[model samples]
Target: MTVLRGRGVSLSAATEGGERAVSIDVEAYYRRYGPQVLRRCRFLLRDEEKAVDAMHDVFVQLLRYQGALKDAAPSSLLHRIATTVCLNRLRGAKRRPEDREDELVLQIASADDTESRTAARGLLDRLFGRVPASSQDIAVLHLVDGMTLEETAREVGLSVSGVRKRLRALTAVLQELELEAA
Candidate 1:
């Protein structure tokens, strides 16, 4: 087997469909996107340990989808994968007795105004819950995390205009919700 270096990882290239193809370099992926993934997990889970675990889980998942991921944009795809992983973990926590304690702790430790934070998180959950998963990722990356529009677009694999349009529509809906609440 021949070894190929990709950002400090060794990957063996293989032939598929009579074309030379490269495998996913887990280490390279980690080196490039690990901190960002960790941040996403931490932002959602609000627990240092769980965030680390979630980041690891996402990489493990990347291994399973390595072939398909070879053609993907690493950052955008990883961001989406991290979001899905964190969301799944959150959902799973709700169903597990042991994890429930951790969830409660995370909720409480997330902010001083626990009630307002919970309400805001709930509102976001409901708002993004009604949209496509990509939209949720965009909202979290842009509005919640305060990433610029260009950054959010690049991370989400959308054109700037496309992301702008989505944000505008999302803002309108949120404004309507605010009006109704008021």
Candidate 2:
């Protein structure tokens, strides 16, 4: 919710992990990003308490991955992480076998535009059905959250070309699905 407001300059420490694990100023980051992350959670989980919990969980994940963290785009990275955390929670809530045909991926909550949100809500399941699950993540980040290709690549830990290929594959599958739908 909060972190992806824009590109963030890196603020890390060179000290080894201890009581201070991440180099970044943690309190400042929470103050800067916590609102947006909470906003994101509320939008997705549709529960105030759950949203708060998930937002905190996002920061915890950031702490967990601080060692390998390279990109300065904390907002984008945190947004992706927040989405992932909430989706996992949603998925876990319904622990039955994945009813892929009927289940909507809750990450599409980022499709904030009214028309696009409605449009995306229905197509997303079909889109995921026809392509790799990772592509589904790419589509949500790029197409739904409106992150640029490079930003999406960094967030998803893929090369831009690799992201492009998966997106292209998604387009092909979408075309086939559209033709079938028609």
Candidate 3:
């Protein structure tokens, strides 16, 4: 979404001669792009409270880096921020799963699936070990989160073909690993 031009608070910048003002239309940006950012948070978080919190966190990051972030692609920037915020929350949850593990266990635990779990763990290590985490993020955005290749490229700051090549290489690795497993 485009950051609409309008009245906003100005920040002081230290220049060669003196301090100057850098004005950012933050309200206009929030008005135009808040819904998209909130939707992305909700999709990734699946919790109303956390999603709202994450949305606010994304905007806070925007405000924090207002001077550096350009207006060329605000939508993609917000989307990327939302994804990162939610992903960080998810990782944090892993650090302390006991708070919610009671119900989660009932839903996802399988007593007889040790072999499957081991196999899946091996597959994950092999797939993720050789690649950068950005590649894994791309895979999640495109394959898990259902983002388009163009969207994924924008979020990851890569070309569409670069994202595709990463995915292709990942797929090839998976295929080879599958054959080895077989």
Candidate 4:
């Protein structure tokens, strides 16, 4: 019996001296990794439906590239593929700036109490509106989504240092806004 390097499965040699590779159980693989892949894709794509499509595409790509993944860690491979798939989906698509603004507004509108929620929404709207569009996007991707600076850079097609600078600028603007509001 010979075991595949990273797949954690063993296969027996055939009578004719050929090693028969075990068939991939795609469903089991999906079941194990589906949620993780979906979460990563959703973080990158932001749209639930687009994230689902990207998840499916990632799985398909994984199946097609199974041979190459024989020696790679499955989780790392899945994350890398999911990130690439999401970035590809984002590349050709035109995102509506208003949609993102509305989404952020809605998130701010959902706080615990009605009065606080309204105040938060109003503050966020004013602050975000005053900031440059690029800064708003970076702020949302980094602060709201809890994405790392590297992930934000990947999503926004910015360098890590560029993202860091943008985030710092945004923070300064937010601080000024908070002081003015107070």
Between prediction 1 and prediction 4, the one with superior lDDT is: 1
**Pairs in steric clash, model 4:** none
Clashing pairs in 2: 1-36, 1-37, 2-36, 2-37, 3-75, 4-75, 12-23, 13-23
Prediction-by-prediction clash tally = 0, 8, 0, 0
CA shift of 110, model 4, Å: 30
Cα RMSD to the true fold for all candidates: 14.5, 15.4, 13.6, 10.8
**Residues 28-117, model 2: lDDT tens digits:** 678888898899989999999889999999988877777667546778877888899999989975752222222233435657788978
The lDDT values for all models are 0.74, 0.73, 0.73, 0.71
Instruction: Write model 1 residue lDDT over 1-182, tens digit each, in one string.
Output: 46667554555665655665568778788988999999999999999999999999999998888866664578888888999999998987664323232333354346668687888677666666666778768766765566877898999999978886776666666656667779
- What TM-score would every model get versus the actual structure? 0.47, 0.42, 0.45, 0.42
Over 12-95, each residue of candidate 4 has an lDDT whose tens digit, in order, gives 334456645444444566887889999999999998998999999988997786654553366787899899999876764443
Model 3 CA lDDT for position 160: 85
* Residues forming the 10-long window of minimal summed lDDT in candidate 3: 99-108
What would the TM-score be for candidate 4 when compared with the true structure? 0.42
Ordered list by lDDT, greatest first: 1, 3, 2, 4
| Candidate 3 colliding pairs, count | 0
Lowest lDDT sum, 10 consecutive residues, model 2, at: 96-105
